[model samples]
Target: MSSSAFRTVPASADVVIVGGGVMGVSTAFHLAEAGVRNIVVVERGELGCGSSGKPIGGVRAQFSDPLNIELGNRSLRAYRDFPHRPGADIRLDTVGYLFLLDSDRQVSDFAAGVELQNGLGVPSRVISPDEAGRLCPYVSTDGLVAAVYSPADGHARPGLVVQGYARAAAHAGVTIATHTAVCGIDTAGDRITGVHTDQGRIACSTVICAAGAWSARIGDMVGVDLPVRPVRRQLAFTAPLTPPAPRIPFTIDFSSTAYFHNSDDGLLFGLADPDQEEGFDTTWTPHWLELFRTAARHRAPALADMRTVGGWAGLYEVTPDHNALIGRSAELPGFLYATGFSGHGFLQAPAVGEVMRDLYLEREPFTDISPLGADRFRHGAEIRPEAHVV
Candidate 1:
């Protein structure tokens, strides 16, 4: 749909969502499934126009944090069976996820992580460098002492998943207004009154902040300081190889935080910039390519010969603890949060949708998300950080 159709916002809605990415649409779908259909999803631009569409689509359960592992497990199941549940084929391929370790210290940390992941039924195990090479034949495993491989972890088409949720939500009578920018969140004495969009005002008592990188801005409107900051992450892809490489698992060099995976007979790779400044800046830089080239050559020497085809930049809604902030806000009663997943939001959207829906309906959530609440930061509680976040 074009922006022209969104010239006028509805007078009111039972619930007003601030973003139309995968998280918002999935939340709407789950809410509709739970018999709440009077929902409005307002997107500033097209659905999945943000980080949701730009992720390399890696999904895994090999996490150190217990809650993160649980979220990943549930999301993995949903991705495996999403075609029936959400009625869309996301092209989920469980080739696997392999993390290469360059030192014994990393191996030791990963071993502990594997123990916890296996305890939670993740089936992650440590392997020798030779074994890792066998898993990914092209990767040069030099200077690598160990590796962690989880066969259940994989990648999927992120855009398709978002579209699937949007379709399901629309079918369930959830109104999605694209190109509608939210100007302000109206409140009256600590209670949400409505949302003022660029088009018009929407009289909604409940407002959900699923605005991805812009979540903190939305929080500011309601007098709440959501500790979510936008950080730029860049990815580059190579043209199709001459001899099509074998299906490669999502491989990460844990030391440098550089990773790559198979995509369209080519390779999709990226690196986390250590000097990247916080804020919304999506410019693709040559310095990033240089950093990635060095990392890739050290991990997979063969990749040095492949010419760069194209790439994109996206935002990571990084929190202080590199986790998510979910649940209702104490400052404002009806204001809820479903953002700040760092870079793991796309993979965990399915399970988060269900959890948020349950919380909104005053039912017991499938998993205990108390640790991920905003109050954790305020109360000075110890944050259980996820170790493997590439």
Candidate 2:
């Protein structure tokens, strides 16, 4: 099968993934490796053309929940093992991540999150504000009481990771439809039998809805309302300064809302929006710059001189609890739900893909998916909220 084969022919399959982001491609690849062919992945746009292509490239295991810790750890392993590629390697830089202690409550919760990450084999620890400055010489440590530092935390290029998964899936004979969009679901009785798409209809027994920001919309098509909504996140880039500032780590100021890192040519930066708290809008405004500037000054005053070269907005598939909602949907049989990743989708994609594969192929899940299942929401189960949800 060639790259353009799907464009020339209308094909059917045993499984159809309804969003071609990192989740869809990663699942398709692993599923193929599990010996289940006839897999078709449909994307509303080109692969990695969604938020997968627009991430700030953050990867870390510093979460309060053990499930997320496991997910982050599992995905980090895969990233560590990704075969070396020339040109644009997904630079896995372990420059460390420090979540600055903001308040007493923030400090207490970070202690718990660090303990959880450590229990799950993550090398995260609590560090004094001075230690935070040691890791990133440019960081402003004034009034910063303490920090939660994860030395194992780092970042990888989003486009490279997406392409790696897509290439591996294609090499394994998985049908990856780049420009296809799943319009709706074709159901008979209580089970899904096929998928309705703009290109044509696809006959399949199992369907995985990995459609990130559009997850809620996809759920509506199948009568399963996924509580996933897109919250716009803006990232700004700066031109390289002289001497490169000694390879800074990905630092987050819990005291403030600032986060910054060293990119290839320059540095990448992001901050929380002061407005809405959460929403599904990708529209950008000047207010975001204010938020970034205010946070940056409180965290690292040196960054105040850095002028923004440009910025782009990406939607975070956020849930009510700010954690990913993964598992089977009860309303729609033979259909599984895997979205509402909040902002952890990219880092957790590899593990989430395996979780989906295990559920679909009847293999033992790497970890328990019961906690993340949609049934929890139906039964009024609460997802444990993490204070360090960056």
Candidate 3:
């Protein structure tokens, strides 16, 4: 659809989904496909202008937790079938994901994780350093003790995924209101009545918050706690190589949180800065590239000094436990949310969309997502941190 068509916001909708990123669009598509009507997705900027606008997104089911694994695995299947279903290529490259380990403890932990993933049909396994080197020739394998490999796990273009879902949703009668900033939420005796946007007020009985990094503000508007904070994550792309980059797995140095994979004729490098402050700032700083360089000097020496043409910076909507918050509001039944995905939102969008659709329909989802409710933090529940984060 053209930008002109998305400018007008409807006065009323059966469901108002805040944020037009992958999660929002996916939810819109699923709900529309499920026979729900008069759905409107409100976005402050263009669709996928938020975190979902990233260039390449990794899709994997190699998680230490079963819930996360199921979410990833199920979404991977949807992404594989995206071209036929929602109908878009999305550029999914199943080059697989490789996690390089340096310590015996790391190997032991990954072994347990591999066992769990395999039992859940992830096809992930622990391989020796030699096998890891064969999969990704760029790796030095100097300090690498072992590595976890999942051939089905890889990366896809997030922007394309967003467009695919948005197009599908729009074609299904979903009104996608771009450049429509949600200003306030109307409530009455614990029930959400409408959503006030910069364009206009939309009277909606149900509100789904897939607002990504800005979700906490939306939650506050409705007196619901989302506990999501935006943290900046940056990555750089290498200049076109003299000899085109080799086909390699999406490789990661687990200890340093450094990762790299083939992109175009070069490679893309990224690392999580341990000292990064929590905020919504997405300015792509060259300083963080040094962190990736430092790790590469030890893990993959060739990438330590590779030239970078440019890069992209985006936000990771993080929760205290680093797990997603997916549930309906206990106080306000009309409000529902699926955010705080940390860095896994794009990979898990499809499955979470289905969960949100089922939740809105008052039907049990294929997998029990009750444990991921916001109430867990309110009750001080001890949640395990996902170990396979990169």
Candidate 4:
């Protein structure tokens, strides 16, 4: 498919997908592979311009809950096979994931999480701090009590993954309309009638909101409450090391929400700011590096003084419970959503695409996602809080 194909929005489509990040393109690929035709993906900007464009894409199945573990596990397999199936080299590095724990409570919680993950076919295990240091030399065993390591989990290139899925989907005849902002969604009673974009009106029978940080507005267009809020997460890349950094696991100091991993000849440092306010702003604040440096000073002292060349900031489509929303709208059956993934959207995109495809076809998905429905919030229900978030 030529670049011009992605520029032209058609008059109508059988299904209209909002957002062209990893989720949207993945969904389009799955649906197209399943023989669904006349599909159109509408992106406000170029593909992967949203959260999906972030560097340091970590793929892991080390979660406290089974749902997240399953999603991550399934997606790991897909990412591992991406080069063969979707036919793209996403620079997948299976250096593994190491979560550093400080408190006894963190140890116990992670132990339980490891048990659950193991039951679900993930080879995650709790190890001593000494073992953690062996896996990643930079990790200090000072205050660390225990750590969790999963060899199957790692990181990949999000942009390449997006392009891979997008190209495959477009080649299968799915229309990908970039630079097309969705002005509004047209609905009649309990069904999606069409999607109105700045380019034109696309008469679609179904509308899928994979809009990530902007999903709440997309839900409002159809009278559905997605309850998604955007929070800025930032990370910095260190200058190229003189001797090149050692390949290490995607390591995280779980207690402080600070993390670091290998990136090219340097390293990437990130920390979730506890005081960060909710917004769509993605301006990379270099001062935020102080938070990670502070944590690293205590956890991994060597990383605190690393020279940072530049950084990237992106939004995490956060939900109250910090889990993903994946299901069809009860009120508007024609409307489906796969958003509010917090920071795990890129890692879980592949499985989510398959889930959304099965959902649209009214077929049973590989795993039951009933618990992830948007209606959970309306009914005063929330899934268990997922630990191991970085």
Model 3: residues >4 Å from true position, as ranges?
Answer: 2-8
**lDDT against true structure, model 3:** 0.92
* For every candidate, C-alpha RMSD to the true structure in Å: 1.5, 2.2, 1.1, 1.2
List clash counts for every candidate, in order. Answer: 0, 0, 0, 0
Each candidate structure's TM-score, on Cα atoms with residue i matched to residue i, is 0.97, 0.94, 0.98, 0.98
- The Cα error of candidate 4 at residue 274, in Å, is 0.6
Error of 2 at 155 (Å): 0.3
**1-390 per-residue lDDT for model 1 (tens digits):** 212347798899999988988899889989988899679999998998987977458888888878989999999999998999979999898999999998888899889999999999998999999999999986787788999999999999888998899988888888889989999988989889989999899998899889999999999998887899999989888888878878988988898888888888788878898889997878887568888788878888887667887798889898888899988988787999999898999889999999989888988899999888877888898476665255
Between 3 and 4, whose lDDT is larger?
Answer: 3
Q: Indicate the worst ten consecutive residues by lDDT in candidate 3.
A: 1-10
Let me know the TM-score candidate 2 reaches against the reference structure: 0.94
As a whole number from 0 to 100, the lDDT of residue 220 in candidate 1 is 92
lDDT score of residue 369 within candidate 4: 97
Residues 317-389, model 2: lDDT tens digits: 8777787778887767688868888778899988898899999977789898788876666788878865424
Model 1 earns a TM-score of 0.97
lDDT of 3 by residue, 1-390 (tens): 633334447889999999999999999999999999999988899999999988999999998889999999999999999999989999999999999999999999999999999999999999999999999998998877999999999999999999999888888888888888999999989888998988888999999999999999999997899999999999999999989888999998999999999898999999989899999889989999988899899999999999998999999999988999999999999999999999999999999999999999999999999889988998998479775255
